[model samples]
Target: MDIKIYVCHHKEGPFFENEFFKPIQVGRAIAKKQLGGMIGDDTGENISEKNDNWCELTAIYWIWKNTNHDFVGINHYRRYLNFAENSQNSTISLDKNIDFLLYCSQNIVNICRSYDIITSPLCKIHQISSPNNRQTAYENYSFNHFESDMKLVFSIIKEKHPEYYEASQISSGLDICFFGNMMLMRRDIFNKYCNFVFSVLFTLENIIDTSKYDYYQRRVYGFIAERLSNIFVLKQQLLGGDKKAYHAGQISLPTFTRTYDFSELNTKLGFVNHPAQTAIEILHGGTVHLVISFDDAYMLHAIACIMSILDRASVRDALTFHVIHDESLGSPNISIIKRIFINAKIHFYDVRNDRFPGLLPRNRPHISKNTYYRLIMQDYLPREVSRIIYSDLDTIFLDDIIQLWNISMDNAILAGCLDEGGLTQSRKLFGKTHNKNYINAGVLLFDIQAAKAKYGNLRFLYAESLAKHVRNITLQDQDLLNISFVDDIIHLPLRWNVGSRIYGNNELDYAYSEADEKIAAENPAVIHFTGENKPWHADSTHPLKSIYLHYQERASQALQHAQR
Candidate 1:
C-alpha cells in the first residue's frame, strides 16, 4: 500500500521526514519564504490564504484535492501519531530517542493494514475539568469559545447534513471526545470525510463574522473541525446496516520536544551568548533540573525535600539539583549536602542577603528575605538551563518530578497551580484592576529563558514594582509575582502542587471546584505545607505531616552517615 503522511510546517525548524513521511508547508500563499524540498498547500485548488483561520485544515484540504495515495494522513512538525511497539498505547511521550519513537515506511504499512482509520485516543471531559458541573462538549465549547458560532453550526448541521445531526447532538452531550484533527484512512473514506467536514466549515465561514475575533479565536474553523471529526466517526459507527461504514483505531499522539545541546558553550564563550546566565559546568540530555532557595533555618526541610525527590526517582531518571542561598548556608552545611547528594548532580549558588534590604514584607516573620532569591534565577541559572522547576523548602515530593518537567510550557513565562485565595489577596494589594487567576508560587515551572527575555532583570523588575505597592505587599514575593507576571502565568492542575490550605478553606477568592480539590488531595505529586502549620513545628496539624516526617528521618539518617 502507498502511504504519504504529510508533516505540516509553518516555519523552518527541526522536522522528521522519510519517503512515506514528507514535509509540506501550509499557508504558503501568505508565507514569505518557500522552504526548500517541500510541497506547498498553495498549489492546485487551495485555501492557503485562510490558513490563519483554518490552521492545519489548509494542509488537510491540500492533500484531499492534490494527492491520490492509497492511505493519506496529516501530522504537525512537533506532534505525531505513535504506532511504535514501545509506546504501549497508554501515555504520551517526548521523542528523546528518535529511532524508538518513530516507525519506518514498511513498519507503518504493516501496522495500518489491520485498521481502517487511525487517530488520537479518546479523552474524558470529566478528567480535565470539574466533575461537579459535569460539562458536556457543547457547554465546554461555549465556555471557551463564542457560543453564537457553535449555535450557528448546530443550525447548519441540522439543515445540511441531517444524517449526522443526531450524532453531532449525541457527541455534544457526552463526556468523551477525539481531539486533534489527525487521522489516516482509505482514499475514498478520506474524501467522504473531507466532503462532510469542509461542507460544514465552509458554510460556517460564510455565515460567521470572524473579523472581530481575536488572533487565537480567529482559528474558529479548526476548533470546530476537531469536534466534527468526532461526530463524523460516531455517525459511521451508528450506521445501522449489515456492512459497517468504518473501523477506526485510536492511537496516542506523542509530542516530541526540541532537544538542545549546551555542551559547546562549555568553551571560552560560555558567558557570551546568554549574558544574564552563570557559568555552565555540566548539562546533558534526559535530566530534570530543580531550583530552590532557603536560609539556614530551613536547611533540614530543604534536605528532606531533596531526599523525597531522589527517593522516588527511577534509575533511568537523571536529576540535577540547584540550591540558591546566601552566606547563611555555611561551609559545614554545604559539605553535608555534597555527601547526601553525592550520587546525584548538584550545584550551589551563593547570593548576598543584603541585595534585598528594605524590600522585605513587614510583620511577616514566617516569610523570610530569602523568599526573594527565586526572582534572580534568570541572572543565576546557567544558559543551558532554559527551563527549571522551582519549589519552596516547605514541601515534599510524592511522585516523579519528571512528569512536572515534561509539561509543555506553551511559551508561557511560568506554569503553576492556581491559589484559590490569590484573587482576594491581589485585590487587597493592587486593587480590583488585577483580576487574572493567581497561582501559588510554592511549586513553579519556569521557562527561564523566556522570563529573561520578557523581563531583562526579574529582580530589578520586582524591586521596581515593589516601590509602587510597598505598603500593600503582604504575602511578600507571592504578591509581587502575581502582580508582575499576572497575564504571563499558566494555571496547571492542582495535583501538581497540592496546598494544605485547600483541605478545609471555603471562602476561596478564585473558585476551584470541590471535585478538583478532592482529586488532587487523593493523588498529589507535590504536597505543599502552606500557612503557618509546618510538619516540623510542634503545634502543626497538617494530616500529610507524617509523610514529611518519614522523609525527614531518612534525610537525617543520610546526613548522619555522610558526617562519618
Candidate 2:
C-alpha cells in the first residue's frame, strides 16, 4: 500500500526524495521495508504554516501500534529539538552502513510483533527455516548476526545512552534479540539489511528507559520499540545528560558461554542431557564427599539425580556417595549409570553407615528433644570423607552443581537449604538450640575435613537430642537438619538448590532467578526440582522437560532391548 507521509519540506526535495534529511530518509527507507512510521524533523527559517515542517524532532511519542506492520495512529505532536540551532532549521545525520540498515530491520521485526500481530510487516507463523524438521521453542536465543547488530546498537546506544555501556557488556543472553520471538538462524544471515526499518519506528515511539540514563535526562520513556537485543532505542536528544551513562557501553557484559537449550526441554516427556561432571570439577577441583540416604524404597531415583548432577559438571573427580539403606531395593543398570558417567575422571565410593542424629544425638546436642531424625547427620559419613554434598532423590540437574560444590568453605561448618519462611515460627520455641533461619537438610554441603581438624576425635558423633519428648516436625529430615546447622551453614545461591515448591509460588530473590514476565533471551544452565516437579512425575513445569523426555526415549529403547 502506497501512503504519503509528509515530512517538514526538504531543501533538496520534498520528504520522499530528500536523502540528506536524516529523519525523512530514515522514515522513507523504513517505509519501503514496510515496517512502520518514520521520524519527522525539519530545520529551515522562512516560517510559513507548512514551511515550519516537523522541525527540531522534539516532541516525544506517547503510545503507538497497529494490527501488523502498519501504524493506524496519527502523529501526536510536533516541536523543535531543544538543540535546534534555529526554530526553522534542517539538520540530518545519516550513515551508509548496510548492516546498520538491517539492524534497524531486526528492531522493526520485534517492534511489529509487539504491536497487534495482524498489521506486522512480516507474516505470522511463516516457515522459519531450521536445520531440522522440529524447531526450538526459543528461537531468539542466539546471534550469528550479533556482531553486526552489536556494532550498530552499541554505537547508537553510545551516542544516545552512554550510561548503559556497562550493562550492555553484561547482557550475556541478548543474542537473537528477543527471547523465543523468532526462528532458527545461521551465522551469515545476520548481515542482511533489515536495519533502518526498526529505528524509524523507535524514533517515533518509546525506546529503552535505562537506569543510568533516566537519572540524568529527567525524561520518561516514550516512542519505544524493542531492539534486537530487546533493549529499546532512544533519540539522540534523550541522551547526553547522564554521567554514569558516560562511556558506559565501553564496559560490556559477561559473554555467553554455550547457549542453554530450553527448546529441547519444553516439549519432551523425558530427555537426557550429555554426561557432565560440573559438580565434581567445582568442589576442591575434583574431590567431593557426598552422602545419599532415603527411607522406604526410593534409591534408583536418588541415584539417577546424583549421576545427572555429576554428569552435567565438567569436574567429576574426588567425590564419594554413601547409601544408608536398611534393605536392598531394585537397582538401576550399572551399564547405564556407567555410560552416564563415561567421561567422569573421578572416584566414587559407597558406604552403608546408618547412624543419624535422632537415634544417637552424641556428636551434636542441638537436635530438638521433640524432633525425630529421618536423615543421618554428618557424623554418619565415613571418617575419611569431609565436605560432603547431600542430595534428595527427587531433584534433577540443569547445570553443573559443582560450581555450587566448589563454594569457598572459609568459615561455614554446614550448608543446607535456606528456611523459606512459610513455617518460620515453628522452631522459635527451642530458643538458640533449636534456632531461627535454620537450614533445610534436603541438600547439604559440609566441611568434614575442617571438623576433623577442629575436634580432637569426632565431636559430632556424640551429640544427643535435648528433649524428653519428640516434637512432631512438619518436614521430616529438614527440621532436625536445620536445627543442627542453624549457626554453621553457608547459604547457597538460589540457582544451585532451586526447588519445585517455589517454582511459581515463592517470592524470588536476586529475584531474576524465578519465573519472570520478561522472556529469557537465553536458557538456564540448570533447573532443579528439589520438591515435587520431578520430570517423571505428572506435575512437572520445567521449561526443559522435553530435554529429559529425550532420555526417556532412550530409556524406552533400552527397556525394549532388555525385553527382547
Give the clash total for candidate 2. Answer: 85
| Clashes found in each candidate (C-alpha, N, C closer than 3 A) | 0, 85
Best by lDDT: 1
lDDT of 2 by residue, 258-353 (tens): 233545435331333444342233436356565555432443454456656655656555545555443332244433444444554323232234
Candidate 1 lDDT at 446 equals 81
How big is the positional error of residue 265 in model 2, measured in Å on the Cα after superposition? Answer: 7.9
Model 1 backbone overlap count: 0
lDDT of 1 by residue, 245-345 (tens): 22233332333222222243123222134223221222324678889987777777888998877655553246788888888888898888888787778
lDDT of each: 0.73, 0.36
Give TM per candidate: 0.51, 0.40
